[model samples]
Target: MDFRKLLLVDDEEGVRRFLGLSLMDLGYEVKTASNGREALAVFEEFQPNIVFTDIKMPVMDGIELLRIIKEKSPDTEVVMITGHGDLDLAIESLKFDASDFITKPINNDVLEVSLERARERFTMKCALREHTENLERLVEEKTSRIVELERQNAACQVVNGLSSALESASREVETGSGLFNELPCLVSIHNRYLEIVAHNTLFEERLGNHVGDNSFDIYSDRTSPGNACPVQRTFQTGKGQRSRETFLGKDGEEIPVTVYTAPIPNKDGEIELVLDISVDMSEVTRLKDELFATRYKYQRLFDEAPCYITVQDADLAIVEANRLFKRDFGEVEGHFCFEAYKHRSEPCEGCLVDKTLLDGEARQRETVVTTLSGERKHMLVQSAPLHDASGRVIQAMELSTDITEIRRLQDHLTSLGIMLGSMSHGVKGMLTSLDGGIYRLESGLKKGDAERVDAATKTLKAMIGRVKKMVLDILYYAKSRELETEAVDAAAFLRETAAVGAAKAASAGVEFVEDVPEGLGEIKADTAALSAALVNFLENGVDACEGRGADGGGRLSLSARREGDNLVVTIADNGMGMDRETREKIFTLFFSSKGKRGTGIGLFISNQTIEQHGGAIAVDSAPHKGTTFTITLPRGPAR
Candidate 1:
């Protein structure tokens, strides 16, 4: 139970404190003091519900303390403590409005009864205070609503009778009389007969008076043909309306203005007059034109920017794309940014655009893109956040710089470096052969030995042919290429490839030959590409055969035949074959096994050409067991 508080006071500590325990037992929070002066100080700070003070205490007796407390807080009930048989003091305390008398041989029963009475009164006082505050808050809310209603009604009254000054002297609005003259606006009022009864001084100064003329005739005569007169329409609809109108002023100048009309009702709640207010809108119209000019200026800049710019919404959908972005990405609006720019079914992993929106921070990433029309581009993408008023990201702006050509040039340079590394030894060996041939030819010319001269010439011719093939391979890898195909006899094609490989194989003392079936059918192929691809395979086989030791006895051969719907060509070499690692990476571009004698891109480019002809190539090789490369091509239309 929550307790009410009690204060006990007497000259002797024994009686006052002894009374405190009794009051506490009766469920009162008790504070005890030795005298009335001490009791008054405790009461001021504690604000106990009941104070019991003795009339004969030494400092400022009970009667005077009771008077002071009742004056300061009339609700705090004070009780007097009297000695046994001290009837007169108790009766005197009652005059000061003391709550109840307690005899100080301090009876516990009397204290309990007195304290309970004070608690009842305190609880009632608290309830009344809360009720009063609630009532005041409700009154304030109602007053605010009523004030807003009155303000709206006052505006309606002023707008309905704005130009009543010339109607009837008694019909003029009292409050708006001074406002009407001070405001700079066009104002007119017409009676139910549709005849103009009044006009503002400003209106009269600019458009002339129309005191007895009809409203429709006043505007219709000056109106640009088809537009309805705003004032006449108000009478027809019996409701207010607004429209833009241009008038021929008294000065003979066209003045553009926006007209507002309101219906005025009399005591019978029927339409009585139509009030027209027109405001000159020439300045607003000029500002709107300027705004459009500014937007047009920036729009031109955005469209013609050198870099690609795209505006994306919160969902990462491309909402707007500038001219450059549209030109490169091909009409990306209404598509998700990743789908439009990256051609991805889902968003790109670790997409910086998504990160920028989530954190409201700008981000940048470099990416490779294949466009809608199959052009590949490399872009440096920069995404920045566009935020709303509360600092939440609403959209993201991406600016992409095209680095496609630059990236292509870099790839070309890298391929060139790998090419130089792969073929340096081959070129060096060929140069040595050319130097020896020239030395032998010069020696033969001095000694008159035609046999030595002719042999040197053959060696030089063979080295030149091999070096020229390497140069062609380099040229093919350097550019974007297309195939030139023609119908050719399969046997004739195999014979050509063998003739080219025979010279290189002879230099290494290996047997190089082709086994094409006599009745092989004609096939459609890019002859140059097909020959180049077949030469690469034959050269690799010869090179593998030469890698064997002098006593190992090497052989390289090519065999071709038709198998079902495919042309199967197999090149085999009985020499040093490849291990598992080399076989796996044999066709990988820039991967070489011949130290400095192999151009790693030769096999790679060959595989690409064969695949373009709707073909596939497979390699079977094992260490010291020799290697076989099989090429399969469909005997169908070219890719």
Candidate 2:
């Protein structure tokens, strides 16, 4: 079978049975043992590639088993299973070369991760061993061939001896063996006089057969006695020398190179010939530059991204933010995202980043956010998880794109569509009333009836007023005009506005109460717009009270006063009050709760006008309870 072999050892019988089955399910040929001693017996019989043993066990513990296994088969991967209390023992197993350790009540995912790691290590060791054996055999064959071919020369004899020693101590060379295989490395032997005695094939090809030449002559900077090359340094120090040096190539070009030199000692323990190796660094330098440029490019892209990008840790703290984020939100690193982005004391409800961190799934949400400048914007927020090599989510990235303009445009288009649909029926009804009034007036005039003519005149006048109000509302919704603000006496402005509402309320049999006081404050406002806006609210109160009719005990109140630097105006009504849903959408464009009598534009324009005067409006109401609107307007221009 193409399955891996695993040995499971634990003192408990249940652990052995359960864990053995789990290992088998993971594509491992599993065998169980009740103790470390029993595990050793099975280890010899099964020769498992991996051994998972509990740290605390009878007869032999996992640490002892690990030591024994490493001594017998160093390539075998041993993983320790220990309780939380036996953590120190598990750590000690690492000293014995155990692959990994897992605590008791082991998680299956953790177990699989450990197994995969052990499998990788086992495969690497096997591959490395095979490579070493092949390399040694190749060196031996090449050495024999060189010995036979160059047997006639004395210098060749010395070169052959040095080559044999180099092959045997290749692992002790300390430099990467792969570099030697990939690059044309210059290797040569220098005598005690710093004169090159022999050289390798690449050395002869690159440095031009420098057998009897001075070793320092090959280096551009070490041509003088004041500066010695790597070979001369090795001879003087009686140790290995490694440094960056420049070599003069055979083509008369300066080549950047890394040089390594080792001293070959004589039988008397004295330094004799020095073996030198130099590697051309042209390709390596280019690769290094390319890697650096790639990293820099990615970092630049991350910093200069158009949208606001923030990397948050598992705790939802902002670890890194892009340039735009820092510029808008201010250096927000180490702060919670909600605090920095939304100005909330805690995390946002159903946060997209939190969802991504939880399930490692990408998510998106549309939200409204306020900037430091107090400008509110609509944002499309997206989140994605950042993972480590083991596929565990380490952090999450949140990207927010500003969609405020898009939402505004959509609202405008939606308002137009709803306006046309809603106003059509109301306009049709008003026109029909106007037509009836005209017919009555014509008939009364022809018959010369004074009472009928007077009644028809009153009806025609009322119908014309309704038609005029509807047209104004349509014009205001179609194009908003800039405010022509001026200083106005709060008491005078509010009283005049309340008088109109009071007459309407009295006509409908509802009480109108006013509380305007003299010398309240001068409010900086667009006089016409603010007056019209306040009158709109007062009229709404009258209409709300009128909904209850004469017997409903309806009442409407308008009050104005000065509170610090603001003028506070309140309009209240005891009528068919609104629920929470109606209150929330009352300010939204083209949203009306009234079935047919309402145009829905009065309150929207009123709210906008109040805001334009740097004022705020708050509404408090509940089902069956009366509605109260408190408007706070600045006494001066907005701060």
Candidate 3:
């Protein structure tokens, strides 16, 4: 691989030289800039693959430097160094897709880790860009040839047939990019038995075209598709379906997509093949919202919805107001939700709608509303999060049902739906993993290949064992299954956990470590539940490590020891750690930092399971700093 072309931007000469040398020590070809203005000048000539800049600088600040560099060379990874007080500004830099950031007075380890992550991002960006360029060129060449052939034949049908033949040939050029793969969406075709038949560019790059992986598993977010996956729903119902869904991308980021699936039925009206299509709606959502705001401004029920309905964004800027909302609250469009509804210049205290935006979940509360007629009415309000195609909450729809007339009222109740969603994500992964092994085993069996079958068998056994454990845990929690607490050796337990996670880490090019003193004393614990809890922690850490960056081997470790009468276990990783906001709700149901990649159940389940064992989970983390999760369990046996 070519050396990473790096650029350093800082007003202070010592700061630039110091950081520049540090990168050079890591085998990078470094370039230095005195300020953002100089950095831009060097950038045009040096074309740096990665950049490190101080947030504060002369002529141009790091944020401006980031904006310019991205506007021009978006593929270049930029890392910012900011002070503690500039934390919020640094976060805003990330919105511009900054690779990573570090605090001022940076620790060498943290800086190195940040650079390593930037390296990984740079690699992926280059690969995707190259793949796209190659595809475009190939399409052009083939298209020109087809045009030449069409000119030689004046027959329209012949030209059309030849043109289509070119497309078919183009589709067969490679598994990653198809003739139509350049289209603004992920497209694929699958056969019966859930096997992927073919796929396009974005599909292959984002989600590998692993030939035999089950479609249900590949497309589903959680253990089960749960009616959210268009492909699964279509296959089951033998009908076309369109909806929104989230898929995990390369590096484990969540990709929100709008999906459409249709079945290609045989002559007897029997489905033999299915077509899957998904589009990234980030660039299109604003247009969609605009269209909805105009076209549906007077939607049929807007004048008739029994409740007050309001649509607003994060700033509480009212996007649209229903007829009832208008009459009761006065023409509120183009005004703040709070100003219109509560007559307050600032947002209402404990704003439930605002909370929905923060975590991308629904919120409900009973509030008293005053009408223009000077009457107070009791209303049960529900604010549902409206997410963009990328799964980030962008807006919310508030619906308030009037309950003033009712003499008796029931308490609002919410189910643990997030738990079920997360379980489905886990199940989805296990299904595909086991399917891959099964495919290899079956293929080997047909060819009378013992070695292949033997290897596949091992894989199948391990994956199936994991699935069985998860199933048992769910069943036990449901009812009737016996729970047995036993004396488990600390070293052996941690070693096994490390072993379970090693393969995953290796696959992602991450380093997995286990450190537990031999003969570290046994602890009384519910073997299954505790094991499941710890494994969840391990898996999450592994995932975060991968997302942070596999460059320089993303590090994850498991360590355990006995603390007096308490057994303490720690799972730590130098991965994309959480911000304070993210950390606060990680234990909440459906709270996922991984976007669509997380079902938000792992930490929640881990917390619940640990608490059940008379234990507590503590966390130490910051964005890009890494996270350490410590689990403290009582040493005594069952009561």
Candidate 4:
């Protein structure tokens, strides 16, 4: 039914002619050759869709012809014709891409069925090839469309970027123009040729027709050009200029003008324009005249002021000094007050200047200074930072009052109060140790055993040691004993203290770590006093850890290092820390966290000793997190 031509190959002429006639009757154009060689020549000339040949021939065989036909036209189908004795040979030809085989005397029904099958196969192959070509064309079109879309997207992005840039530039120009119009002073802009290009409302109202012309022609009617016009000077030098002048307004009244002119640069870093601003100075001039008439009164009050006053910039450079400041601390100009009077290159350890600037408020601090003349002065210094209109700190004013004699009297009174408050606790601790020793001795005498007596003797010695330490703390607080200062190794002292507390920490199920750097150089101080202060801090850490371990275990850390010229000792514990109010009051006398177990004099005594050494103690703590007490002691003795 396909009307497709077929190739029937065999050596028999009779079979070929019959098949060719049969295909022609079936409405297919047909051709035939007797042997395989003739069939190949006829096949090429006819370009038939099917071929019929004999199995055995003179020059070429059916199998050889089958191979050649397929090589030339793969779409053509081959049907081999064979005799009864050559059936095996025809069957073997199927291996050569043969379509089908027939017997010697071909059955007309079977032969026609084979031809129809070959035509159906050829029709399917042509349909598949056409489908493949269509798919290839579709793929090419889709790929081209994707490339075009990508190119368009890139072009749109460039346009969008340019649009955003133009919008931003327009906004900036509008903001700058608005600010120039709203300013209270007279403002004008001039191009490189010295022609006025823009004038604000205030400038036009005051000067009338005089503006928009050269500044020299407008202001030089009564005075020389250089003396009257500051804008001309700024244009000539390409630098900023400021001066004062008297100008007659439109109402025929004279007004003082303080003019300031500056150059505006172009893209090439060259001054291509100038901006001039003029401020009316009538009120300022009137105030100055009034102050000039009362100068004597101000001079008298300045010299008789009680407090020393000095003006300094943010860098602490002195700009002005009052009479009292010069008289008391020597003339201090072009030098910082601390370096001039205290003779130090840097500020004191706990500087108040930083605090004032950070909080933007007045700060007060009390410090001691040993002047160049060997005079020790204690002063209460109060300073306030001065801010510009933009809220930027530019300068500071400092006032210092001599408080040496006053602080001495206050310290004497404070010492008396501390002694009275601590007397009961101090006396009780000593008596308790003394009583324990007496009781142990009495018990040993009654037992009458040599071993018991020896053990009791050691107990008595330990009790006596406790009593001696309490007496020393009391005497030190009262300043009743002279300090025995010496150079002591800080690292060695820290190791010894950690060893004593490590056992206690282990008993409480807490880990204790000692991180002391070895070979830390010695610091000049009273060895016994320094050791006592460090031990007190360690004891507090141990107590805090024990309290925290009442519920679960925590950690205790003791570390020491020589940081620059100071020796730093830190004791930290993971325990219930104090609140802000409690931390602030910890150094005060009679303040205790351990109600009955603590005498409250440990930290108080430590605070007094640290201050006497010209050192500092600070505590950083947070509730439920922990507390760390850092003690910093100077490497040298106090002045």
Candidate 5:
């Protein structure tokens, strides 16, 4: 039936049932798994062409499965299923070569699009494989033919060169010259009667002087024209003759040799004499070995090139990949270059290969690509056209050089410069405010005004607090410190942090509410860091409420509870909320909604602290509405 095989994996049975049915309806022969562990077992047995797996599952996660599957079968397409809050994980799966991702409450249109893309990729891969196999076979055939031709040409050159030299020597001999004595190989001249009328010194030394002897008489096989030697055959056929023969040497040994003969014609085009040349068999064998070794050396150099090299067809399908490319990206030949190198659904825009193929011109560009191990690399990719015998572009060769470390160092230096610039302004403003507070305090004390002195004391205390917080934030950003974790009652910790937030809210005329319940379970985290991070969120909530003004019914609340193996905390405020742009940048370093009143370091530090404890924060807010931050932390400390 040509049925397409698909494996559907999820921890939930209900999801598997519904998704499997949907897949079957779409013409797939589907198998289901409850988790990644089971999915792998099913995968090995079923060998499905496509797999749909949930990102979060028991035993093993989809990201791990994706990596394993890609290692085992780079051609298999894996699509990740995830929840709305797992967008980051979904994006991560793509780095491991996931075909595509679908969120919870999967849309039919999206699923269909993902499936179609998978099918297209699979089909293209199959076609590429077939084409590559055929090309390799053709190349092997052509190589064998070329080697044989070269060997023949080498032997023919030796014979023709010697024959031509011997012909010249014969003319010299006719002129009573002694040039015939210097020829390298066994050479002689024979007449129509097959008589060796003349012989070179090499022939006389090896086969003994045979002038006036029948040419066939020197050969171990033939002794007369009835059973002709190469010399007799050349005269009989009126053409050149080449054959293997055994020569009777002076020592009476049967020496194997290659005999070549060419008839020497007179001016009237009548054959008057035949030139003979014989090379030792061992010499021919050496020439063949040299040809083979030279070819092998070239092949080794191609395979061991430092950068990743691939030969691609006009379609951009990889026809060949070098050893290093195969080692890192798996056996990716017969796949599209974009899919294998960049893990993309289609060719990259302004692809170098495409441009090179079109114009027969070399091209180069810098691009970022993800490796099979999920590491991102910056590569300098260059492509050159490969032409056929007719000078038409048939394929393109692409070379990629890894420049990841270089790019990383450059990015780090740029970020450091920007951070220092931002910190200087914030520190300067805080120092200016501290100086103003000191001047106010001195004036109030010198005037002996009790009310003015009290006001000055409060201003000085507030300014000092801000300055102290700014210093701590700078220190935290300057270096990373390990967490010293300990277990603490979640309810008690939440209440203690809430008391401080509540007092601050009261002073600002903003109502504060606490929903911390007893027995909320224990959480393992760095107590000081976790407390400060949570307090930062609460204080921000209080500020939001105070900014909304008292008449706006400003209110802030703190709540915490245990959810499964994690502690879930919520800090919400019915106050001045934020737009999408502000919300997105809230946790970014040096990004703040408040202008002069904020240093833009509190939320950034809080976010870092939460992440260090293996926690996640989700915020939901709308302009003029309200804001809620949902923080989820594991019950146990990070491993």
Candidate 6:
């Protein structure tokens, strides 16, 4: 046992000493204090577990000290020592959380008993706290386990529902009965004595007339009467077996019925009963006759349908195709879709068929297919998820429509717009050149100088060349010709385009820089077309930078690099950028921010040319900040 430190506080020194010695002899470490004040000091220094205090003290009363000690350490116990007749003060101490009260003449046995009771109560409190903590932990663990089990049970139910539906369908087909019949079929068995041991509805309906008769009498025509019957054979196999039999009706007509027998197990695992079901096949005979008569009509509807229709199983194997589908793409039943149509050995990445089955929802997708003959076609496909009776998706019905012609029409319209815009721009540039040359010629005629006449003649020839080039561009845009591709170093292309605009940038007092990386990989594109596009972008940048003063003059940066499988070229300018409304319409035909001074064909033509090269162009700009036009083209040498 561990010894607890005990403090004895009293105004009388002799009484304090006596109690201290008694507690020390009782296996406690005891300390004595003369008054309540001294006792509190000793209590702090000694760190005692229990305090024994007298009621009356010189500076502080025992009741006050007990209250202070309890406030400081609520777990510590305090015993009040009072005079023989001071019962009121003892009661007061107890109300102030004193553990126990003892009179002036303290009984040693009562003190020991009170201390033991306090120790026992504290031990029980600790044990209860620990037990409560453990119970809470266990409850939380069991709750989580229950949630997991419920999830598993729900999954199992879905699988079991499908299994049961399939089994029922098989049974209906084997017994040759209507699945929706009210009282479908039943089976029964009897022992050698011919008692009514077991019988199904079908057996009862057929053999009720011979009831109360022996089993051997009804089946006496069969050999080996003592051996296993057909029903017994079914029991041994635990599966249903069917046999054909003819019954003579009351009017002398013969009726044919198919009988099926299965085994029923008892508690001891013995097959004590047999189940029989009889099905009438007269309706089936009529259905076969009707199917042959209408086959031609159904075939006509299947072949003439407008939609590109095909049937596929869960594995996406083609099971059937309509006439239109077979005509466009060769007969592809039983072959994988990617192999037959896409001419690939693998399924298309991000296949929508798999998604439709997993979610059991109708899905639509647009895909580009490269046919076996190297023809690329864009197709829009819609697939309907097909589910079995139990709601499990088993297959998909797909309808694909060719959208290649539509895309071509859209591209043609875009090209037409670009051609008209470019024509306006070229005409405007020519008119500006003519006006400048005529003014210079008129001034030279006043001076009578041959040099000015020669300069004017050269200017006229350049204007004619410009007009011819513009006509050629219009012709190229109108004709549907395959792209002529060649290898061109992108870095050199950017530098040449930037150099053409550098003189103009200097005259306008604007700074221009080429940041393209040297030895940047080449790209496959029409060299003349690509050069024209880059020059247009550079001219636009220089024009935007023109009016801003030398100190506030704009800056232009041209950069080119390879990003992934693309060659990216960026032309950026720190100039007066357009507002949101103007930027939105900048690429539209006849839309220009420069009013009468701009034909707006520069960016629009650039957009078309990049798109033709299988590339994209995007403009990022904000008012008063700057503008950046980025062109991304597929990376490879021109073919």
Tens digit of lDDT per residue, candidate 4, span 146-192?
A: 99999878756654554354333323323346665577777776666
lDDT of 1 by residue, 1-639 (tens): 233777777788778567767667666788887776787788889987778788887768889889999998877778787887778988988898887887767656676776777667667776788889999999999999999999988866765564343234314422235455455677777777777777777777777766787675455244332344776677779788998887657676667888888877664446687777788777788999999998999899889999899989877899999998898788899999989888788988998878898998998989888766788778889999998899889999999988988887888798788677667877898889989989998998889999999988988887787688678877888774887778788888878878887876877788876788876787789888888888888888877887675545888888999988788999999878999999999888878788645667789899889998989998999887788989988775367
Q: For model 5, give the 10-residue run with minimal summed lDDT.
A: 173-182
Best by TM-score: 1
RMSD of 3: 47.5
Where is model 2 more than 4 Å wrong at Cα?
A: 1-162, 165-182, 186-213, 235-239, 248-255, 262-275, 282-286, 303-421, 431-464, 474-482, 488-521, 541-595, 611-634, 637-639
Of 2 and 5, the candidate ahead on lDDT is 5
Local distance difference test, candidate 2: 0.84
Q: What RMSD does model 1 have?
A: 12.9
Q: For model 5, how does the per-residue alpha-carbon lDDT over 350-464 read when each residue is reduced to its tens digit? A: 9999999999999999998887888787999999999999999999999999989888778767765776777677668877877877887888789988787788778878878
Query: Against the hidden reference, what TM-scores do the models get?
Result: 0.55, 0.51, 0.30, 0.33, 0.53, 0.35
Give the residue spans of candidate 5 off by over 4 A: 1-307, 313-317, 323-349, 357-361, 368-379, 385-395, 402-423, 445-454, 478-486, 492-515, 548-555, 622-626, 637-639
RMSD of each: 12.9, 24.1, 47.5, 26.1, 37.3, 22.1
Worst 10 residues of 1 by lDDT: 166-175
TM-score of 2: 0.51
* Residue-level lDDT tens digits of model 2 in 446-522: 99988888989988887887788778888987888888777787788788888888877887799889999899967
What TM-score does prediction 3 earn? Answer: 0.30
Q: List the residue pairs that clash in candidate 5.
A: none
lDDT for every model? 0.79, 0.84, 0.78, 0.73, 0.85, 0.71
* Candidate 1, position 175, lDDT: 26
Whole-model alpha-carbon lDDT for candidate 5: 0.85
As a whole number from 0 to 100, the lDDT of residue 609 in candidate 5 is 90
